[model samples]
Target: MQVSPIGTFFGDAVYKYEAPRQGRLFAGHPGRIELNAGQNFEMALRDLDGFERIWVIFQFHENVGWRPTTRPPVPPKGKDRVGTFASRSPYRPNPIGLSCVRLLKIDGLTLYVDEADLLNGTPVLDIKPYIPMADAFPDAKAGWVEEQEGDLWTVLADAPFDAQNRWIAERSDFDLESFARVQLSRGNFSKGVFDSTRRRLTVDESAHTGVLAYRTFRIHFTYDDTARVVCLQRVSSGYTAEELQEGTEDKYGDKQLHRDFITLPDFRR
Candidate 1:
């Protein structure tokens, strides 16, 4: 079989199958793909910032050959492996990869991105801007991929699937107001005490759907017309810490507990 060359990528892009199967993986461990050496790197990245997200078409420079069937990160039902075309595994006959990466920032020809599953220095063939009206599907069905959708944490909590091998640096500077707004929208709130003069809120959202089935966490937030402060609380009845500890267990039931929430300091800093 003869395959026409689409285009060459610059430096080998970062490969991160470690990324969640979907774009929501941004809040998780994310890496980058530096493109600047394959073929026409600068020409392809021109005016890329105009798009909030971009569809990156690239080659699986690492994939050696074809495979009839491959194992997807999450196998459906009783199926462990499916036809190559049925899944997005890089080990395919063509070995082509398509990723819609969130355009974080752009500098000249280099595009900094998030929610990218690519590896460091992976080759990029073509780039296309993403339009929400066309790219987002409010009623779209993912077929087998749909079964894999759930709480981003639960899905990504468990090695390759859980980022067990990767190091997650706790980002201490996440904007509290922004986090408070998000939590408030999810309807996780209850009135409480504040810095002595003002009242605060403890937001809690408990539902069996989406992800995090045994949900029991609260966000300590206070939002005014100006700013907001947000913190975390264990809300799983008598089981918050226990469940979290269980969720972080390794694939082989190791003792190392995966710290779920970033433990907040006792007194407000």
Candidate 2:
């Protein structure tokens, strides 16, 4: 059997980590799937506009290989490892993915979709309309997934934090707000969820604060033990003054991009 790509998905999720774990959890970066006009794909898309959502079958272009068993990024402490089939691990025998994305509109050969988990330039193999009658399984047992429920925590950003996020957005390629939401949304921060092995987040009991490293920046925030909410305080560049002066491009690779971020007034502070 052979499969060919009918279209390609385009979005701001340039990196795998940048994408939301699930399409339904995605917070609003809309993308487009532009089908090949020469392949008569337009004819196939007819009457699909009425559907509220669509299932996008795409290729995981960036993933090179697979692992039989892998540890998930945010698994419950003792139940960290799981079979590939049981988890939505990107590394699979077949580098194929399916996402149920909200169909916002259709313009000619292009489909504007929201809540998309597809990365930029991901090859779209096929598209199918989401039928609620057949697909809805509200009472279906989800096994381990059901056990993982109730772990989700809330995140709140104050006005100053929002301002800092906006500042970072203008200067860097990173989506600071989305990254914070994804990292802090489900963790058991109250009991000290810092993973020393991964060094993703470091919690300071004395200061009642936590710091999460994202690329070349550190996200400083405070987590409320009782409220189970993470309040972002500020963002700081990891690059030293000498590194900024000498050029971060040689060290960090994205020279101009790093320079743009380090030179921001917020970074100076």
Where model 2 places Cα greater than 4 Å from the true spot, the runs are 76-78, 170-174, 190-200, 246-269
The count of backbone overlaps in candidate 2 is: 1
- Candidate 1 lDDT, 1-269, residue by residue in tens: 65434333332222232223444444432444455455576776777778888888877777698889976544565666778888887777777789887777776555667666565546666678999988888897767866541122211122221221122213222222222222232221222211111113322334222211111212232222112222222121213346446445444332232243334232211
Task: Assess every candidate by TM-score.
Answer: 0.48, 0.85
**Could you tell me how far off, in angstroms, the CA of residue 254 lies in candidate 1 after the best superposition?**
24
* Highest TM-score against the true fold, candidate: 2
Q: What is residue 119's positional error in candidate 1, in angstroms?
A: 1.1
Model 2: residue 138 alpha-carbon error in angstroms: 0.4
lDDT of each: 0.44, 0.78
The window of 10 residues in a row where model 2 has the poorest summed lDDT is 190-199
Q: How accurate is candidate 1 locally (lDDT)?
A: 0.44
